[model samples]
Target: MRHRRGLVRLWDYAKPSWRRLTLALLCMGVEAVCVPLMIWTAKELLPPILQSGQSQALRRLDLVALAVLALGLLKGLASYGHYYLGNYVGQRVIQGLRGDLFWHLLRLSPRFFEETRSGKLISHLTNDVAVLQQVLSENIAQVLVTPLMALGTVVLMFLLSWRLTLLVLLGAPLLAWVLQQMGRKMRRVTERMQQRLADLTSLFQEVVLGIRIVQCFNAEERERQRFGAENERTFAAIMKGHQLQALMTPTIEWIGLTGMLLLLWFGGREVILAQRMGAEDLIALLGSVQVLITQMRKFGRLHLILQQGRAAGQRILEVLDLPPEIPQKPNAIALPDIQGHIQFDHVSFQYSSGEMVLHDISFEVRPGEVVAIAGPSGAGKTTLANLIPRLYDVTSGSVRVEGYDVRDWDLASLRSHIGIVPQEVLLFTGTVRENIAYGQPEASDEEVEWAARMAYAHEFIVRLPQGYQTWVGERGAKLSRGQCQRIAIARALLRNPRILILDEATSALDSESETLVQKALERLMEGRTTLIIAHRLSSIRHAHRILILDQGRIVEEGSHEELLGRGGLYSKLYELQSLQARGEGLE
Candidate 1:
């Protein structure tokens, strides 16, 4: 029952395709029947014509030959049906699994990505899905249909002559024992091969992403050696898997050879001495022997294939069965159109370490208020801002929007109301217009232009040879860092979100670009709840209020002028920035 439950769990993920799988099985059944019919035709047709020299037997032979030919045609047609329908079912199952995996990964908390490598996650998405494809298309047919055909062959052999059938069946127990052990070894090697393949994929992605770093450090030789080592390990694993698979055929064939020799010696004595078997019966027994051998060979191959598929199926199942970290309640309420009155009430957050990143951090931003959070590098300013969008759940308190806790609102509704412009500028490979209007796909050309203008992106975008139609290349590589930031801002602007988050949005720009971006920021901040995490004192100088954070606590909070007068942490930071701006420090 436990094993049955495990298989049921695997198949449950291939939802709505049980009907297609049924059709594939029906086709396989037709093909299975054709095999025995063709064998029986050969057994019953030829002998009478050879011995009797009767005209009637010749006519019977011709009729049986035509029937075998027709069955052969039917088998060919069924084979095609099996391939097409099985492939269709496999593709559908993979599509559904990939879609679910992708959706789950995208919705997972940011910390998930922080701890996981991009390459490893990508391996799960691509290699793991391909493994499932192999299982569905190849292993499913073998597991379901091959064994039935083998069993039917054995039963038919017994009906023809129980003595010969018993001789053949004598080896089945020994064969089963050998195969069961081989299957265990195959499953182990298959899993190790999959793990090594994932490692290779992860290395490939990391190298590509950090190619510039590799070039800068002149570490090309180091990277090549690293990649070569992983590739060698992957190669060794695959060779081991193939070696295991290769053993199945010869080992099973040797067992069959021993059993066949035993049957031939004993059955020949029965026919020659006892006169108990007719020529027709001898022919039938020969055909049955050949058919039984064919079935055993297929069974051996099926066992190996099944083991391969089971290994991959188990891996795919691991990801599909990952319980969602933040699932919506059945009766979850849809959030109303937000007014952007954001409040973090006694909000405390800890990373997986249980060490606090934000400790009892409480703050509020009224609609149309521009609030700035300033601190040293590890002061949790960004973490506090992240809670507004529910990127991470507060450990012990509530982050509310318009009086409702974020956890109570549907995830999509809560996220749609907020737009975040991260410190790192990420843009897909696409035209400038598409990149700018990324957040709101249906935005009109005029709307896109308006957003670009507000972000001070239109001037440079028009300066490019292709203007808004130009490709950004991967990660907007063709554009400068400042250009990418402006494009990101344009995307957020087009969304027209109720709340805006700027995480050092101007940190990458030059003085000229920064000046333009600051103007754009002023326009963006108007009539919206804005949370700014800034290191540059000038960027948040006009903020309605500023909060200084230190060691996960709000050490100081006030207006820019008020904080300066009080001479707290904010005052010290401001003084340090002024000294640097004046070139009073060593330069």
Candidate 2:
């Protein structure tokens, strides 16, 4: 039942190209008829050669040769049309399907990305889809042509000798039963092989992304062993598939050959002793049966290709079937420019695993206020900031912006007015100007340079080989940490967001870079409602107020001086950091 549904979905993708497929089928029909006609002509030529005088026989031979040449030319033309049209339709369908898959993936929520492996998704887009393309372009022609060819040959055989045709028909059910059982096993084996390939892809991606860590720990050999083990498993699954395929072809051939030998014996005796049919008639009958057997063997091979395609199609559909986690309301309104007031009212949040990360969090930041949130690691500081942008919906209560719940606002409009600068900045492989202008693609070159100047990145950017056009390597590998952070700031500044989030933006930098980045960040926070999630106590000293959290709830809320005087968790944390800065050992 599942396979049936998959085939129906595949047909829907192919429906737009039905006109080309119909033409290909017509060519296949012409090709099928030509095979039987050629055999009948050969049978008729034999009697004249055996019974006529040399001159008459030579004349008959010349006419038959001309007839065979014309049929061959027609067959060749039809074959070309069938192949070219079939592949063209296949490429068009795959192009449409691949495009839709990518577009759907972009709309999925962050939670889906967190739970799914990036490598497996990549495999679906590339490897699995390629398998379906092979079936559509190559196997589809044989799938349609073989059955037509077989039917035409069978009709010609019955015309020559019905007795021999009936004997051949008796084995049809058994051959079909064998094919059915072998095909079921092949489908199961191919499905397992595809999964193994996906696992191999995921492991390879993991190693490449973490090559730095692997080299630091001297674990190259260990990673190699891991990859080798996965490769071995994939090999095993592939070998099992090959074994079934190998066993099936010969099994089909033996059944077909056995039926042919039986027919030859009966037909030979009738011509030699009973004189019921001539030798030329027997020869023609055998020739038609040979064509039928060849078509059946081709059908057996097509079955395997179809099963592999079904397995691949199933994987691609699985991704498309996932419902979007965060669906927007039908009447959601676009958020307009306003005072940046954000309020979290009795908010509690949890993940898909049911572990609550925030509990009864109630806070309100008035327009243009700078509120810093300080907490130990895993204290839900980042989680609280993520809620403002609607990256994750609140499980219980509501988060409102300027007197409107975020859920009531259009998703794109809501996010456009917000900017986040994370600790580890990610820059795409592009020029400095392009990265800065990412948020506003239509921004003028002058505007990009202006944003860069405001972020204090213009001076260093102009010194590079290509100036603003210098290519940053993957993830900004070519640039220093401070340079990447400054570029990120410029990107946010280009958007001119009303609200900003700084999640330990300068946490990983040296003192000099931190100072430069801090200055850029100060300029970014002016007149914007800002949430600062930080662990270094010194950074938040100038903030208007600080909110400290522990175990998913607010433990302290006060100004920097007030929190120091309280001698509570905040005081203890501050003292510990102060001691660490002085190069003192913790007991």
Candidate 3:
């Protein structure tokens, strides 16, 4: 029952083409009937052509040739029907499964991507899905057809001579044992190979992404050596599977040979000594045995192929079966455009490991309020910003917008109304206009340029080779860091989200770039309910109110002057920065 579940789950992916599958099976059934007929034709014609000298022998031989030819034609047509239709179903299924896997991956929590490698996920979608396509299209046909061939051949053997059939049947249990053991070995090796392949993929992605680092460090040789190691592991795994598959064929063959020897010895005595059957009957029975062996060979080969696919299927299924970390409730309603009133009431959050990052934090930002959150490194500043968008749900307490818990809001609607420009800028490979209007792809060209102008990006953009139409390379590589940041801001501006988050946006910029970006940020913050996670204390001194977080708690909260006057952690940090700026800093 459990095994059926696994197979049924895979079949469910293909169920969309149930009609095609049914038609394919009907075609396979027609093809299967041809196998025993061909054997019977050979049996009927052999004696007349080889031994009998009767005048009608030639006619009988000719008739058998025509019958065989007709059967072959029927088999060919039926084979094509099943093979093509089966493949069609297989293609549709894997395509759907791949789409589903990608869609699910995109919907998973941000933590999933942090913990998982891009290369491994790519492997699952590409290599693993390909394996499933091959197995289902090719190997699955054999799985369905071989058994029918075997059963038909066995029935013919019984009709020809029940005693010899019994001998063959007696060997079935032993052959089954050999096959079962080989299947286990094949599955183990295939699974290990898949794991190694995923590792190799990860190494490839990492090396490509960090090629500049490798070259800058003059570590090309080291990187090559690392790649060689991963390549060798993958090779070792492939060879292991190849060796197992090689052994399986011969192992099954040797068992078949044993069965054949037993049948030949026992069945030969009946024909030669007792005259119980004609030489023609013996030939027919032997032909049936040969057909049975061929079917068994097909079965064994199919088993080996399926084991490899099964390993891949397991990987794909692992991802598909994962429950989304944050699932929308059945009764969840779409959140309307909010007034940007943000509140955190005793909010606390932990990662998947359950190590608390925010604890018992309570705060509120009125609509259009400019509140800055300042803290030392690792103070959960960004995490607090993240909770506002439901990137990670609060571990305890509630984060609310407009007096309603974020969980109550529709995820898409809520995120759509909130704009986030993280410290790290992300841009796709597209024109400036496209990137700027990504949040709302339907925005007009005038609107895009307006947003760019608001972000202070239009001034520099018009200087580019193609102005707003210039193609930015992958992740906006063709643009400067400051340019990318401005583009991201323009995207957020086009979104026109009620709530905005700026996470150390200018920290990575030069003085010239920072001045431009800071001014742009000030413009962006004019009327929005903003949460500023500040890295440079100087940047947020003019913020209406500041909240200082430390070790997951709100250590201080007040206007910049008020906090500085209190002479606490904020005051000390401010003083240190002030000294550092004036060249009177402590070493």
TM-score of every candidate: 0.89, 0.92, 0.89
Candidate 2 TM-score, true structure as reference: 0.92
Error of 1 at 515 (Å): 1.7
Model 3 over residues 328-367: C-alpha lDDT tens digits?
Answer: 8666656667789999999989988778999999999999
TM-score of 3: 0.89
User: Which residue pairs in model 1 clash with each other?
Assistant: none
Q: Worst ten-residue run, lDDT, model 2?
A: 1-10
lDDT of 1 by residue, 385-503 (tens): 88877777789889998788888888888888898888888888899998987878899999999999999899999999889998886744388888888888888888888899999
Ranked by TM-score, the better of candidates 2 and 3 is 2
Q: In model 1, how large is the Cα lDDT of residue 267?
A: 79
Count the clashes in each prediction. 0, 0, 0
The 0-to-1 C-alpha lDDT of every candidate, in the order given, reads: 0.80, 0.88, 0.86
Per-residue accuracy of model 2 over 292-384 as CA lDDT, tens digit each: 877876787798788778878889888888877778999987857978889999999998878999999998888899999999989998888
Identify the candidate with maximal TM-score: 2
User: For this target, which candidate reaches the highest lDDT against the unseen true structure?
Assistant: 2
Task: Give lDDT: candidate 3, residue 564.
Answer: 91
